[model samples]
Target: MLWFLFCLALLLGGYYIYGSFVEKVFGIKKQRQTPAYEKEDGVDYVAMSTPKVYLVQLLNIAGVGPIFGPIMGALYGPAAMLWIVFGCIFAGGVHDYFSGMLSVRNGGASVPSITGKYLGNNAKHFMNIFALVLLLLVGVVFVSAPAGMITNLVNEQTDMNVSLMSMVAIIFAYYVVATIVPVDKIIGRFYPFFGALLIFMSVGLITAVVVSSEHTLLGDYELSQMFVNMNPNDLPLWPALFITIACGAISGFHATQSPLMARCIENEENGRFVFYGAMIGEGAIALIWCALALSFFGSVEALSDVVATGGPGAVVYEASFGLLGVFGGILAFLGVVILPITSGDTAFRSSRLILAEYFNMNQKTMRNRLLMALPLFVLGGILTQVDFGIIWRYFGFANQTTAVMMLWTATAYLARHNKFHWIATVPAMFMTAVVITFILNNSSLGFGLAMQTSTIIGILATVVITVYVLTKSKRDLFVNEDGNAIDDDGIEVVAQDS
Candidate 1:
């Protein structure tokens, strides 16, 4: 009951607080003047209807993050489930919501562009590099994880060969290409169908599994067992929770999703609903995954065995739909197969957009975009065949660290805007500070010393840049001889008069 209340409070608080700020940011009179770039065809650039925007936003944002995040969070126990859901509503949703609004306000700029706007060119460059690396890591981990899962499910349900199953899944990418190749017309039309299928199949499988179960609860284990099994000498709950919140709390991927979705918003007013609402839906999906994990796995050892034998996607699908015999297996296959493709497409699209924007590439050339995406896809495919455990561990750590950067950026943005909703800032600050401290505290003396030095150096650099910006702002020194203030590139700032 308390868990439900906490989750509800976080949800409402996020919606109210972030929703209010989004309204204010778009309310700025200058925002109403649609930029020339945005004045293109309604199919691509012009405002979409609120309903269409909502559907696109929901589909785009609901990816592998929710599925894997909750599954891993459940490793911490049901108590962690509470935070996982609540954190999505309060921290994750708010970050995604405002990030999109900020992008829209700045002419559909990506998150790094926003970072550049406020943090300067060096910061912008660093952020872009960071974002690219993080996205690649995400692409690899997310793609492989689900692929492994699906391969396992196929191997288990049918007499199909494991390698053969993988080939089948890979071939499905060709179908994805067919849908996405036209890029503009087909994806915008068919992607929603795929997304809707994902939701329906997932929900249907869950319902079927639950209804067919003889027992309501699968395990007799207590939540305390999770912490009890942890390394006592390791970091405490506060720090662990903060560091591990990538599965539950804020994510850097949300930054990528925001800009991609921002391009789809039909009305400025619908931004709040689409962005925040999708996150809420993500939280709900996470909750469902956790519930399924708990209901299906009798013990951690059993869960590990299943994942090891069948792969994670296989175990998840089999466990999720195992009750329905052959029919359930097919449903599971559909869900797992769609999961990676959806995520992969989004990652490819986002990376392409970043490249296009930064390099000023021709948006009409699908061939060029395909070439650019091919390298990342091939790299991800190769990495998928390697040991996923090591890949996932590194990916998780790096992903979380990237998320901290995003949280800090968002916190700074909110602080600068003077819209300090403590609901968002408190968790963002607490989580980030805790993660930094934990990483520092848990390292060996020699490595810790090196990390501490680099951290200090980074901190100093950030401080110096911030102070420079402040001094410039106060002295009105940002303006050049022509009286134009410098923008992201330290180039002259030009604000279009309302």
Candidate 2:
């Protein structure tokens, strides 16, 4: 319980202290016109209240990753809490803040567009495909995941046998509308209600854990137990734990979502509250879920058994019901359901924006919007036929790889400006090693190299990338003071704000 409280305090302190410092490093322009006002197109660029933007951003990024990922991460013992707290504070917050602020600086552009400006055309091309694919995967996975849960919940409650494909169709329909419509329609109107449910569910579960006489919070475990590996399969902790707990710690997915809110933020000063603060908020959710998983099961071994048998979804349903009772549990389950649905809708919406930007298509009309969105829904529908587990397996690595790209992109921006580049450079290098080692060590993904071999190779690869970036930082003079990128012939890639 003490450790849990300490970790919670760390998350809160991270927002007030480190979050402010990061805001300064980015050099927020208080009087500067944001894209929300500068590019106000009523559809995507309409300025919104800070509170609404914050809730929209929070719902957009706070998918099942925080809950399910941490539930799975809890199998590794209390060490998961450490990652959720510290990784979120340092890595996720910085990554998200830069992703949003850079987009705001660049006319509400997508991460691929922003990456292209800073990281060169090749990196831009890679991230264009990378971010698009990640968004699609998020869309498809969220669709099937919620559909399945809703199916089970409905059948269990009212005897209506809900087919998974039927639910998928319904969700995809909602995604289509959410993707094509204006930001203020379904998403903005509905998110406050969903965000309220999310808060209530999180608070209620934590309260239940703390006050329950039947179960001791944190499972009566010593702080030293956190360092011990308790995985039933004996998977190595370094890369696995990091990947398993992506959103809670750090997610490249959040970068994709940031631009969505960047277009709606009315002021640069609100960047910290909307971006970094949202990540910290997610970290809290992950901590609560991790703590609940640890305490409710009474031991790591028991939690592992339930997870192995039914996966993390089982843990969510069982724990919510066990702690909150049937009535509150139903509401809690709805909150879990809402998490992915909200993210899914925005995932498709983000995909549409990225596609429009990639093709240079105007989105002012419903026709152009549908043209961009229809193809993605078609692709999403096709992907729904594939195995959910397979897509998720690839998403974990892709998510982190994308995160590494965002960090490096931010590193380049900072280094060129001659600010403290190490803030992003260090995390970028660390995640670079993590993704490299994870793929190489996992038999299904890479060459199935030994952990030592993978780690050494990962280190060497990170070193090469680091040297190249550092050298480029010294040589690159393409960016002007206004944050526009110049080509070799000195042509500006991104236009300066008028």
Candidate 3:
């Protein structure tokens, strides 16, 4: 209970403290118009209230990620709590806030455009490819998982006329419609209610753990031993824990999803409440899941045994029903499944937006929307046939690396403004090391390299990136007389009038 409560407190406190510091550093202005009002196209740029935007962003970035990641990550021991709390606060929350705000300052542009403005054309081009592939993977993973789940539900309840591939086809039809339509029509309307249920489910599990006499989920593991890499598998902490707990802690995927809500945020001042608050809410969910997994299983080794035997989904099933009863289990199941739809559809939507932005194409028309979206849905359906394990590993790599890109771009943005760049730079460097080490250690998945050599290489990569960003930022010091940033091409217009 002490550790669980402490983790919860840190998540909330960091919001008020570090979240506020980020808001101040960004100089979130009250009088300035945001992209929501300035770029009202009704298709994607519809304006919305802060609360709605926050809920949408939360559901978009979170889904079952916080739950899924932390359950397996709990196998790493109590260090999961530290990562969920601090990583979400300093790295994930900060990353989300800056990503959304930067888009707001750039007319609700996709991350690729924003990266180009700050990180140069090559960096910008890399983001375009990275965002597309990542969203496609998100589209596939989200589609396949839920389709399979619904098929199981049908099989157990009734001899339904549905098959997994057919369900995938039907879900793709919905994705196409939702991606093409205006934001308010489907996603905006469905999200608030969907998100409410998700919150309720998460809160219910928390309450059960807090009030249960039949089971206790705290004080079973010591803080000292938990922090020092207590994995029964002896998985090194560097990349494994970070990758295992990606979305719950800090994920590049969140940065990609932020622009969806960035288009709806009504005020610059609302950025903190929307982006930062949503991440803290997700961090709380991750912490709760980790606690339940750790304490409810009786001991750390016992829990690891369960995780190893059943994998993440079994652990989720056991934790949900084990703590909350059968009815609770159903609700937890629905909540987990429903969430990915929110993110999955938005991933398709973002891909459309990114491609449209690249070509200077308009999205207000139905025709253009279909042209961009049909191909993605077809590709996503095809991807569903491939092995999920392979796709998930690659997704993890892209997710963290994308985060590193956004952090560096943000660091450059802050440096251009001459504020404290280290705020983002430090996290960027840490993630840089994590990604480097991950690739080195998981050679079958990445570059087959040794651990000691990987650690040294990771450190060196961080140094090189730091020096490059610092030097590049030095040349970006001067703006034109009109205050437009002067690039090689001449005065470039990146800042949003909003």
Candidate 4:
């Protein structure tokens, strides 16, 4: 309890303190017109109220990460607290804030487009495919989850009454409409209500954990620098814990979602509140779920037993049943159901924007929007039939792999502006090593190599990438004071503008 409280305080304090400092480093100016106000395209670039933008951003990034990721991460013991607090403050919050701000500066462009501007054309193509895969994973993974949750709650296996097929159809339908409609129409209108439900459910869980008769801190589960490994799988702690909890800790997916809200923001001042603040809010939600999973099961062994028999989804159903009873169980189910649905819609919306941007097509008309959206949904729906476990395993590593690019992209932007870049560079380097090591680790889902061998190669790759980035940052189209990249020609400055 004490450790959890400390981590909770750390997340909130980081927002008020470190988040503000990061905001200053970015040097926001109110006089600089945002893409929304400057362009005012009614489809994607329309200005929205600050609260709505925050809610939409929260729903887009939150999804199942803070909930499922934390529950799985908690198995590694209370050390999960260490990653969530530190990673959110340093990595996730920083990635989100910069990604959003950069998009705002670039006329609310997609992440791949921004990567092209800062990192170069090749990186642009790589991130285009990278961002697409991650978004589809988010969209597809989210679809089945809510369908399963609804199925379990209804306890119906038939076609008409309530079924997975029916649920998928309903969800995909909503995704299509949400993708095609204006920013303020479907997503902007409904997300506030979803955000309210998210808060209410989160507060209820916090209350249950704080004042519950059954839950108290056990020493074996308490987090420490020398914490004992309690994970049933006996997985190595170094990279597994980090990968398992990417959403709670530092996710690449947030970078993709930042552009969605970037199109909606009316001022540079709100990037800190909308992007960084939303991530902190997600960290808090993750802490609550992790604590709930730990306490409700009473012991590590008991929790492990349940996980072995019934997956993470079962943990949600059982934990809510244990703590909140039948009524609370249903309410918790509603939260579980609503979360992914909120994210799935925006995932499709982002896919549409990315495709339209790639092909140089306009999104103002319904035809172009549907042209980009239909093929993506069909592919996503077909993928729902693939082995979910395989998809999830791939998704985890791919998710963080994208983070490597996002951090480096942010690092390049910082360097381009003559600002200190290590804040993002260091984390970028750390995540690069993490993904490499994770892939090389002697796990079946990854390349089957010895841990020491993997670590050596991973370190070598990290060094190479770090040096390459440092070299590129010096000359990667350094921007002028007006925030546009300059042409690379001799001594005279070539002033290119945004």
TM per prediction: 0.77, 0.96, 0.94, 0.94
TM-score of 1: 0.77
Model 3: how far residue 74 lies from native, Å: 0.5
Instruction: List runs of model 4 lying over 4 Å from the truth.
Output: 156-161, 217-226, 477-498
lDDT of each: 0.59, 0.90, 0.84, 0.84
Candidate 1 per-residue C-alpha lDDT over 338-422 given as tens digits, one digit per residue, 9 for 90 to 100:
6656655666667666766678765556676666667656665676666667666555556665555555555545434434334
Q: What is the lDDT of residue 484 in candidate 1?
A: 61
Q: Residues 327-358, candidate 3: write the lDDT tens digits.
A: 77778877878877788989999999999999
The candidate with the higher lDDT, 1 or 4, is 4
Question: How does candidate 3 fare on TM-score?
Answer: 0.94
Q: After superposition, how far is residue 121 of candidate 3 from its true place, in Å?
A: 0.5
Flag regions of model 3 displaced more than 4 Å.
157-162, 479-498
Cα distance off (Å), candidate 4, residue 212 = 1.8
Q: How does residue 68 of candidate 2 score in lDDT? A: 91
Ranking by TM-score: 2, 3, 4, 1
Q: Pick the candidate with the highest lDDT.
A: 2
Clashing pairs in 2: none
